[model samples]
Target: MVGIVIVSHSSKIAEGVKEVALQMAKNHPVYTAGGTADGGIGTDPVRIQEAIEAANTGDGVVVLADLGSAVMSVGLAKEMIDPALAKSVKLANAPLVEGAIAATVEASMGSPLAKVLQTAHDARNMDKVE
Candidate 1:
């Protein structure tokens, strides 16, 4: 089972998404990195790196970001991860809500990080089209 990392500007957002994802797939691992519930930004490179490290402990890791800053933060953290694990890290393009669902579903299916990211992206696109 691939693990998941939800990164957002707000920790509440990340936590909310993680909760929903967990509800969808009880056994999957869903870690979060982002701003705190008090609205404090949670874009620390070290924290992001830790979250990625935790997610990577499983088969692979899928990272979903809420915005550009989250993306840059995760990208920076990716550089700090082990080469083998970093190679498996991927960015999910699905929106906060849909991406969480897609990622959870894909992770539960034992999908590779790339495929999970693609599924999330596709789901986001589909949502946009609908």
Candidate 2:
């Protein structure tokens, strides 16, 4: 199954998203890289890269981040990871919570990397108020 990584400025947010996503992807790898190395409100390349490494299980990893710096951090983390592993990782441009849950569900269904990524992106169009 494709793994998932959640990157957020707040650890609580990342962990919360991970907790929810895990409910649907019980057997898949789901990791969180939130806050700075010192546990502040920022993103860390090292931390994100480590999360990516932990999430990787040969299938690949999809990363969802909150806001700008978190997104940039995931990008930097990708460059820091091993080249082969980096190739298998993708930084998804989707809402953090919804994307994580959607991606996790799709992944749990045995979908491929592309399909999982697409599912997460598709969540952006969901009508939550409807």
Candidate 3:
């Protein structure tokens, strides 16, 4: 099954999203990469890289980041990890919370990495008013 990583400037946000995603896919792997080394609000490439490593399980990993800087952090994190493993990671341009939950559900179903990333991206187009 594809795994997931939540990246956020605030550790609480990442952890909270991970918690919610886990609710939908209890058995799916959902890791968090949030805050700085000092426990402040910021993104850490090392943390993100570690999370990506833990999330990957041979299938792939879908990363959902909160902001632009967080995305950049993920990029740096990818460079820090093994090239082969980095090749299996995809960053989803989708809403953090919704995307995480959606991706988690899709991955829990044993969906491919592409499908998981697509499901998370599709969450951005969802209409809440419907």
Provide the lowest-lDDT 10-residue window in model 1: 121-130
Which number leads on TM-score? 3
lDDT tens digits by residue: candidate 3, 22-75: 988898899999899899999999999999999989999999999999999999
Global fold similarity of model 3 (TM-score): 0.97
- Count residue pairs with overlapping backbones in model 2: 0
Model 1: how far is 113 from its true place, Å?
A: 2.7
Q: Which residue pairs in candidate 1 have backbone atoms (N, alpha carbon, C) closer than 3 angstroms, thus clashing?
A: 11-35, 35-42
The segments of candidate 1 whose C-alpha lies over 4 angstroms from its true place after superposition are 36-39, 128-130
RMSD of 1: 2.2
Worst 10 residues of 2 by lDDT: 21-30
Residue 76, model 1: lDDT of 89
User: What ordering of candidates by TM-score runs from best to worst?
Assistant: 3, 2, 1
Q: Candidate 3: which stretches are off by over 4 Å?
A: none
- Return the lDDT, model 1, position 72: 87
Q: Pick the winner on TM-score between candidates 2 and 3.
A: 3
State every prediction's TM-score relative to the real structure.
Answer: 0.87, 0.96, 0.97
Minimum summed lDDT over a 10-residue window in model 3 is located at 20-29
Rank the models by lDDT, top first. Answer: 3, 2, 1
Clashes of 3: 0
